[model samples]
Target: MSTLTFRSVSLRYPPRAARAGVGEKLVLDGIDLQVASHELVAIIGRSGSGKTSLLNLAAGFLEPTAGTITVDGVPIEGPSADRAVVFQDDALYPWLDARDNIALPFKLKGVPLAERRARAEQLLARVGLADAGDRRIWELSGGMRQRVGIARALAAEPRFLLLDEPLGALDALTRTRMQEFLLRIKAESGAGALLITHSIEEALLLGTRIVVLSPNPGRLTAEIEAGFNAEVLNGASVAAVKASPIFKRMHAGLTGLIHASAEEEIAA
Candidate 1:
């Protein structure tokens, strides 16, 4: 059964001078969504389309101005350990090294120091930063820092993961590598994930279900299943997917929808 649900969800930014005469800008409007247990769903939209806001809502960082959001049959009130969020910025503590940063959550929860250290070491290794565990945030590469952030999130062992453009800052090569890492991690972890991203290619490559949102007062514009099987990772057949009719169609359709929506906003 699906563990997350949002019904008639809407969010409004507080009225500012720019929007005061018109109205409070509605960021999200009537978002009705459900993410089943162990399902990886990607939400795609242009900037200001409320993709990050949606993740924030799910993470319980922000409460919806309207409607209900529930996780594990419980209505979400505020941030909880049950849901872990990895933001666009790699928010690792600068002073703490990767291992300590990953262990922070466990430490906060009063887990034994030995246990926290062992789990942190395991997660850092899992994320391919085993030898770099003692490296400070500033010392590591951008991709390595991002991996540390991911490891920290996983250390909590949350039921649901909310990712807000976690790979947005990486270079193209790094982004592709991170994408594969994320796919592999998801496959192995079986943790439900809701990823908010602007990249159509990323969405297509990563999502089981891709959701498109229309900008002004963000509403779901379309939902499409990205028909990628688990084998895509293990098999070394990139050319096949590029040549695939279904993949091409999805790429074109999602790209077109995003552009069209942006154009509509401009014309309005």
Candidate 2:
């Protein structure tokens, strides 16, 4: 089932006092989270809340300073193909076209050139970039680049997908479109995802469960079940959701919580 487990996890960045005159930073404080198979969980927090660090740990891009993390009952020591990450920057090679970018993973895995090309073409179509396969990254828009990134990530058929603010840089309209596209891709691929984002609207629209992290020594503050319907998320129903009494209440609560935490940090 590819379950992910985090047992009393913590992360500390060593003191850079010689340069910054600050003490060692405690980034994550004893976090314990589990993401079950096929679950799409969103982690939301203000800037500098260590949300990215947490995602890095899950992806094995960074080891936890303490405790253990396991994927599918296997201890994670480093990066592996079983987990794929889609970052905020898209990170596509400027020189490579969409097809070549998507084919990089297969090329690295030593898949035959013809097979890689075929798979890349298929994934580009899947990600709505079928006509963009031959277009270089520079020729594509920001949202299109990210679509290519998503296609590249899918090339591995990863069991776990980690997204770090993958749509944060896009324009509002484009972000909304990408959100619906992501939902469709998730449904089609059936890959479990852990998304780190700051947008409450995005979380509410996309997450199966939303986990909010408190600021400074970031840790889980609240976990809310998100029962967003695919149809509602993809249609004009978003306006209705925003107008719903429950939505207004929760949005106010979360926004207040975020600001209150920031104020507390300032006061401290």
State which candidate has the highest TM-score.
1
Alpha-carbon RMSD to native, per candidate: 2.3, 2.5
Question: What digit string (tens of lDDT, one per residue) describes model 1 on residues 1-268?
Answer: 4488999999887624374547577899999998875677899998888898889889988888889999866898899877888878889999898899999999989999999999999998899988997788999998998888888888878888788899999999888778878878877776788998988888888888899998997999889887563546767454576568888888998899988888888899
Instruction: Tell me how far the alpha carbon of residue 145 in candidate 2 is from the true structure, in angstroms, after superposition.
Output: 0.7
Model 2 residue runs over 4 Å out of place are 15-22, 229-236
How high a TM-score does candidate 2 get?
0.92
Model 1 misplaced stretches (Cα beyond 4 Å): 15-23, 234-240, 266-268
Model 2: per-residue Cα lDDT at residue 115: 96
Clashes of 1: 0
Model 1 TM-score relative to the real fold = 0.92
